[model samples]
Target: MSRRTLLQNAAIAGAAAVPVLLAGARSAGAKMSQTAVAYQGSPKGSSKCSNCKLFEPPSSCKSVAGDISPNGWCKIWVKA
Candidate 1:
């Protein structure tokens, strides 16, 4: 193949790989340790995991490691 054709094909392949790479990166997002985010088992006033945007329902947190409580509080909590 001509040098220009090879370069063009490489560019297209790179572009096609971008979405797959991004998807993997997104799916492998890292979560913070409970201690790192000052996680607590109870609410802080009215703020709690259930009301936080990062809450994953039942007993999980999108940004916190291990089992979480709906009534739990953390420094990273954001109003849902």
Candidate 2:
């Protein structure tokens, strides 16, 4: 292949690989530590895990590691 053709093909391949790499990164979502989000066992005002969008039912959180309490509060808490 010519030098220009080789570079063009490489660019195209790199562009194609970008979406795959981004998809993998998006799928591999990492949760933050409780301390990183300033998580507390008790609710902060009206904000609580049960009312937060990231809170999973029972005793878990989608964005916070370890068992989460429904009455707990965190800096990342978003209203449901």
Candidate 3:
């Protein structure tokens, strides 16, 4: 697998380019900002995230399991 794909499937979430939260920074029930990222874009005719060059198909992510959300976006979102 390519490096990009490897990064996406990593068991270490922070190593996946996601920023790690400070340990003990939040108390119970504290609402943290939901950091949303925007897609830069991809080659025309692209249809799904699994098909993206950066996506690690057939694997689960730290946030979601069963299947990776092709529409999923994050601060690490990069153009294909």
Give the TM-scores of the predictions, in the order they appear. Answer: 0.65, 0.65, 0.25
Q: Kindly list the per-residue Cα lDDT of model 3 for residues 1-80, writing each as its tens digit.
A: 99988877775666644343422333233323324323323323444455445456554333322344665444443355
lDDT of 2 by residue, 1-80 (tens): 89999999999999999767645743688666889789999999989999999899999998788999999999878889
By lDDT, the best candidate is: 1
lDDT of each: 0.88, 0.87, 0.43
TM-score leaderboard ranking: 2, 1, 3
Tell me which residue pairs clash in candidate 2. none
- Give Cα distance to truth, residue 47, candidate 1, Å: 0.4
| lDDT comparing candidate 3 with the true structure | 0.43
lDDT of 1 by residue, 1-80 (tens): 89999999999999999767645754789676899789999999999999999899899987788999999999888999
Selected candidate, larger lDDT, 1 vs 3: 1
